[model samples]
Structure formats: C-alpha cells, structure tokens
Target: MATSTPEELPSSAMTDEDYGAYRASAALWAGTSVLITDQQGKVLVQSVDYRDTRLLPGGAIDKGESPAHGAARELLEELGVHTVVDRGLAVDWVSADSSGAPAAMRFPGELIHVFDGGTWNDEQIAAIRLPESEITAVDFVAPARLPDLLSPADARRALAALRARINAAGTVLLENGHPIAPTSLDRAGILRTPRARHHFTFHTAPVPDTLALRQSWGWVFAPDGRILLLLEPDTGAPCLPGGTPEPHDHGDATTTLHREAIEEAAARIARTTYIGYLSDPAASCARARYAAVLTAVGAAPVDAATGRTYIRVLATPEQALQQFDWGPAAADQLAAVHQARHRLGIPRAAQQPVTELASPITW
Candidate 1:
C-alpha cells in the first residue's frame, strides 16, 4: 500500500508503533479471597504475619492467573487442602490510598474478587494445615464481629459477601468497604449486628389463658405471601411485629397484636390466626406468635417506646428465620409461619432478600 499520512490513516490501519499511548494493566493490583463459613455462619479468617489485621483466607493473585485459579491456589497453599472454590460472591474495587501504608509499600489500587467456599463442618476445618510462614492462625469469626477483628475493607467485603450468600441471588459490587447502594440487608445492618435469640417452649396453640403474657409477636403476611418484619435501630435484629398488651389492649392478645403491629411496623393486619406461643416459664411470661394478613402497610413512624423509627421490611418467612441465631429452632419458627400461612389461605412466600417497605402496599 502507498505510504499514508498520519491523519489520512484509517483508524484500524493506524499503527501503535508510532504514536500509541502506553496502556498498562500492571498499574492496578489484583487480589482474591474466599468466603468460608462454619455451620454457625461465621467467616474463616487468617492471622497473617505481614499485618496486625486479620483477613479472609486469601491473598494476591499472581501473573498469568485467573481469579478463580488464584483463589483455589491460595486456599490450597494457605489452608493446605484441595478444594473447589467458585461462584463470585463479591468484587471490591479499592482505591489507592495516598497517605496510607499501601502507597508507601509501592502498591497501587486493587481489584479483589471474593468467591464462595461454602460451609465447612468440623472435619473440614480440622483438615486445614497452615503454612510455616505468612499465616499464623485461622479462626471462624461472626460476620458482625469481623469489623472488630479484620481490616475495615476486609470486614465490609466479608459482611457484604455473607449477605450475598444468604441472598443466594447474585454478586455484589463494592468500593472502599461499603456497597454503592445498600440493599435492605445492608440498611438493616444485619450480618454486622448480632441476631437476637428467643429461647422458650414453642407451642402450636394460642397463648393459654393460664400463661401471663409478656409480649405478642406475629408473622404478619401480605397477600403476596411475604411476611412483615420489624427492625429496631438499636440492634438491627429482625422481630415479628407485636408487643406486650398495654392497658389500652384490655388484656386481649389479639388487641395487643393489632395495635402493636401498626405502632411498630406501620402495618395493619386483618384476619389474624393464632399460630402458637413461646412460653418462657423461667421468665414467667409467654410471647404469643400469630399469623395475620397485612391489610395495609403505611409509612414507618417514630416508635414512641424507643423514640427511634423502626426499619420496616417485607421479607419471606425464610429470610426472617435465617436471620436469627436460632439454628434448629429456625426450622420450627419457619414451620410456625407456615402453619399461619396455611390456615390463613396465604401461599408460601417465594425466596428473596429482605426488602424495606419504603412505600405503602395496601391490599
């Protein structure tokens, strides 16, 4: 071909040999980690010798390596076990810190991929053999407690990843240590705040007249089968709507349920069906659990009892149950919601992430 002027050259025909800008991918660093949890839903973190902070069992990805390969390799090298680690739980893009040690250590910004390693039992945990260097110890820490123990970025990423796994829906994109737009689980501050456990003898009937009522709670349901859940800012623990019967309730459990449901969740429940009660004889009180239809859900207002607005959500029964530290009781609690839904002619809710009731949904 005839020699073509720089300006006359076709875009595709222009050669990088003369005027190409240097585009180097090497400027950015790449790291990989795995989200490994025990049966109790605690994340496994490694105590590395290079830093005071703890981190998930993962490290830098090497040249010519895919993130998955790097993660599997790191797991094999660090945990000393051959395992299949796939499924992207989260990918966090950390910006280059100017004054921080990373900049001084000759490090640039990083793109880290976190993959799901799934749940490991006691035997799998026992199988781990740490290397003689880098990692000193490994421990399974609660996701909420990760921030206290692990690095801030790692903590945020871990919590987000755990929530993603619980959501069982998709991957999360993050920057720094927070989600770009927090989901309902993130806004509720769950996985970071501990779940409250209710320990009592669960009954399949209404609170007995003989039992002194301590509080009333319900698995309030929407016509769509979603259950109404309430969260207080103090703990971010999801609880069924309802409370102790006040003098206003006139010693009626149903009355207490109706009033408290509106006050706590801004929800109006109709066609209530008593499912069961949680009898705590040691505390000399019983907490009644009922299943009711959500007739109307309004705006969440400041709860007079706590003086703080509660975070109201419409969650599947399973989502609500999994949030508690109930373990086996989670199954039974789910059963209670089922019994309520069944008797009330509401179908089981399709599995989904817990979502806030930002706007009113009236049936």
Candidate 2:
C-alpha cells in the first residue's frame, strides 16, 4: 500500500466549501411554518385533507429555496396570502429516532423553522382564499384551543412560536417544541413598572444594567369583581404581589406569579392572562404584569410565618383605585390590566376566566 505524501495530496479538492456540501447532504429534512394572528390574537390554521389535524400555513422547503422563501411560497400557495417573511420566531429540531418513537415510522428527522406572519386586519383575514385541492377550510384558532385543534407536535410548536412573537426578544431554539435552555429574560414579559413622577424628576446616577433585575407584578382578582392587593407588613402601603424572578422559577413569568401569589398572600391563582411588560426607565428594570383570577383554594392565614404580617384584601376595582396610593406608574399599570381584561373578556366571577387556568395554580 502506498500512502500519499502531504505535498502530493490534492488539498485544493477538500476545501471548506466541499466539506459544507458534504454536511448539507446529511439525512435531515427541513420545513417552515408561519405564525399569523388575527386582531384578537387567534392563530390562522387550515384543515388539510392530507392529514387528520390542522396545519399552519407552511410546508417543506424546496431543494434550493431558503426557509423564509419557502415559507413565503407556501403562504401564497396554501392561502393565497402575499407577504414577505422578514423575521423568524423559533427553530425546532424533530428527531424520528428519539423519545421512543416507533421504528415503523418511516419519515426522516426534520429541522423546523417558524416565522412571524404579522397580525392581520379583519378585511385581510376575510380576503384569504385557500386552495381547494389541498386546504379544506381555513379558520382562526385561539391559543387555548390549539391543543385540540392541531396535532400535539404542531400545538407545541405553535404555542412556542406564539410566545416568541409576544416577547419579540429574539429567535428561540427548541427540541420537540420545548425550549433548548432556560430563559434568561422574557422579552414579552419585560415592562416598565409604573412609578411616581417624582422618581423621574431628577435623573439619578445611571444604574448599571448588571444591577438591574427582572421582576413580576401580578394583578390577582377574586370572585365577585374584586382585585387582590397586599398591605405591606411594615408600611401598610398597598402593592401588587410579586418579586424578583428566581432561578427556581425557570425564567417563567407565570411560574414566578404562581409562587409569589401563594407566598405573599396565600392566594391561589386559578387563571392568569399576560397583560404585557412595563419598562421602568428610572430603575432600568422590567416588570412582567399578569391579571390572574383567584379560586376558592387559597386562604390568607391571620398569622402566616413570613416573618412579617401580610394582609390580603379583596377590593373592587374602584376601591383599589381609591385605596392604593400606587404612584402614577403603578396606577397606570393597574389601569392597563383592567383594560386588557376587558378586551380579553375575562369576567371577574369566581369561576375560571375565559382563558384556561394555569396548571397547578398553587406553587
């Protein structure tokens, strides 16, 4: 056997481009999906004859087309919607061999890309025309109904994509529709906390971004149209129940709300609606606010062991506005929560809100 010397070997043929071509030929399929929402935040979906479950307006990428371009092509073909794909929401990897998948499953693994389809107006939604050959019917599905409307895999991907759209922080990486890593900051949840104007009257020395912390403020409501407020054990001032996002919360705003609701007020949140984030330019911090409805499950112990006294009071919206001296900023946040609740059509009854209750309402 004769071994070729380094000088004699044809190094030019084994260039980086050649290696890239080889890697690209690996046994993997790529597909793209879009996340289009109506004015009400419902997702756009179509009933397909090829599969039992509904699908988002997308399909597998062509041999030489980019993912975004493929998504755009699919949108035009599937729903006759003409639009450009400019932003991506999430990237998910699906493995055919993992998770006890049956060997009989013949499909190869896939790399999935999800893009933002931008919210549409009623006129645009009504103008959509689906291809009769592929799509049977097109309709908008609410987030709560996705699990039942779409296949399990699709539901997970759609939910993650929807969340990413809300956050608008950046693209999310996922495996089997789940996040690849713990979230560091939730773009959707970060918001400025309402503060008194006096705090902003004089510019305090800039606080290093490193010193800034992520926090969650919850607007918990009880049955009979009343909001839950906490009386500060020391100052007797009224405030929302919340605190810093702990590592244990897994960077999830809902998890933080669940834990804080119970710890601070012994209150159980039956359901929570993310009202969006409020930014505090003064503090250089973000506050994720949620409007949650309490169930009959929680109780405020007269003397809980929090090393301080916490009084949980349920008050009507008007009462909350009158009683709490929540400076202008906080007051604005509270008002916004109410407005969001109204728009979401969440009633203040003791029953579950329009949205499904967050699981395990307790910590």
Candidate 3:
C-alpha cells in the first residue's frame, strides 16, 4: 500500500476518544494511606476539610510514583511530616459497587496501599505543620476509638494495619477493607492460644477490644539476651513473671506487668510492649501478654512474700522452649513473641555458650 501522510490518516483513528478507550482498565482509582504511630502506639489520623470523617495522612498516587513514595509525599504535602515509610502494612482492593449505589458511574474499582510511617515522639508530633486548606486538624487517636471516628471500611483497614504494626508480622491483605481470610497473624497463631475443653478456650476480646484479659504477664528479658522464666519448685512448670492484678495495679496492662515483675521476679522493667492476649473461656479468665526489657534492677534468689527459694533461669527463647515446659498456654505466648521479634527485626543480645549453662545454681 502507498504510504499516507500524517494529515491523510483516517479521521476516526486519530480521535482522543479512541486513545482514552484503549487506556481504560478495570480500576478507576489508586490511592495510598500512611499509618503513622506515636511512641505509645496511638495512630495519627487527620480531619480533612473535604470530609467530616478523619483519614490517614495520604492521597492518590500520582503518575510514575510508587505507592510507598506517594504515601510519604502526601504526608509531606498535607502535614509537613518528614518521616520515612518503614514497611507496607496493608493493601485493599475495593469494588465500586460495594461503595454506594451510584458508584459505577464514577469509576470501576479502587486500590489502596497502606504503609507504616514508623513511631514519633511527642515533640515530633508537635512539630507537624498542617495545611489548613486541606487538613483541618491532626491528632493522634487510640486504636480503640478509630472505629467511632472513621467509616466502617476505613476503620477496618486501619485496625488491620494497627494489628500488623503491633505484632510486627508482615503486611495484611484486604478486600473491601476486611482481611482476606487467614491472615499472617491467623496463620502464625500469634494471638490464638490453644484451646482445650476443660483447661482453656481462646476467644477474642470484645469490650474495650485492646486486650483479652485484665490480668497480664511479661516475658522480661535480661541484658544477656535471655528471658526470665520462673520455676515452680514442686511441679517444675515454667511461667512468665506475672500474676493477677492487685488493687494497686493501676494505669494500663504494662503498669500491672511492672508491678508483677517487681513482686514475682524482683526486677524492674525499663520498657514494655503489648504483644497480645490469651483468653481461657473455660475458667472465665483472660491474660494480657507483654514483652519487656529489664531495667538496672536484678532479681532476688528468693521471694520475700513466700520465703521460698526460687529457681529462676535466664534462657534463650529456643532453650526456654526446649528446657522448661511452659505448658501449652505459656508456651504459645513465648512462641508468639519469638515470632514477632524475628519478624520485626529486633536483634537478640549476645548469647552465652551452651557450655557456660552447665553450672548449678547457688545462693
């Protein structure tokens, strides 16, 4: 065929409508969300002038930008935040039909990528500069109150991201903002303690929703990278250093754990992380679990309250799992924490050689 000049090409083939039709896809919207947390684990959400409900600090991903980079860029543009996005928390695929009745006219579907903005101190939060034109106000909201402030879909997405952050388990995948079946947390059994007919039955916490139990326990770690395990003299059953809350156990679960550490292990904790909860429905009781770092204080060989000589062993997570039998419940707790630390990139301290643990306990 003879070559046609640019101007001689068919008029129907060169229209903008044809170009647009060729680029059409199943999805119409692509966005990013940043889940920013404070040192205390409170998520930072903003009230936008465009919407009554609060949202995470993020917006639509621009052309040629990665979802993570887009999230960080949106934070800087909207709130003047300079923090780096650490890891992906979640990715949600939402159908347009599920959004509302008039949705199909607007777009096909939506994809949202959520990233962890890491933790900031009070000073860093105070330093944030919000653009009044877009963001009306910025506040750090507790995870429990998120559902009340955000839409159901947004709330579920945020909560899933929060769970991923708290557990240090990898990213969560969602459809319509709800988890997509057995999540990493579910697969790892991080919060699902074994259930037995008469002994224990694990259940999720409903009210308050933060913990499974009022009573708490701690896997307090010594400076030498060993966890403190208390031994039962007669039965030799190993347990974390904690007990039921007392009248004076005030503040939060960490406060209760701190007191328990002092009473049970004779050690003071510098900091504590809320790992998760374990419920025993058969006994009508539940317990919050924590991983704590010991302060300068050391444990006493004997408990003053019982006047009994205690055999406390500081063992590596592997050794603790093997040597001392923590029963099914306690074993699950330690295993969950071990998995969390490994996932979160928390480094273990220098371990003592196996030969060094051969000596018998004295004093």
C-alpha RMSD of each candidate structure in angstroms: 4.6, 17.3, 15.9
User: Please, what are the lDDT tens digits per residue for candidate 2 over residues 1-363?
Assistant: 211443443356666565555555556889999988775456799899887889888999999999999999999999888899989999999877643545686657889999999889888888788886989998886565677878778887887777566434478898988777523122111111111222221111332345344777777775555566665544444467777778899877789888877777667776677775655677766567777777643545433335654655555554444333333454555566677567545664342111212223343
Give the C-alpha miss distance for residue 134 in model 3, angstroms. Answer: 1.8
Highest TM-score: give the candidate number.
1
lDDT of each: 0.80, 0.66, 0.64
TM-score of 3: 0.51
Q: Per-residue lDDT for 1-363 in model 3, tens only?
A: 211443443356455554444446333688999888775446799998877789988889999888878988998999897767758988899888776636446857789999988778778888899875988888886566687888778887887776565444467788988778544332322212221222232222332454345577776766556677665454344466777776666546677788766666566776577676766555455677777775544535466556654445565665444333233454455567765455444557444421111133221
How far residue 104's Cα lies from its native spot in candidate 2, in Å, is 8.3
Best by lDDT: 1
Model 1 off-target regions past 4 Å? Answer: 1-21, 102-104, 199-201, 205-211
The residue ranges of model 2 lying beyond 4 angstroms of the native Cα positions read 1-25, 98-106, 184-363
What TM-score does model 2 achieve against the real structure?
A: 0.50
Model 1 clashing residue pairs (backbone): none
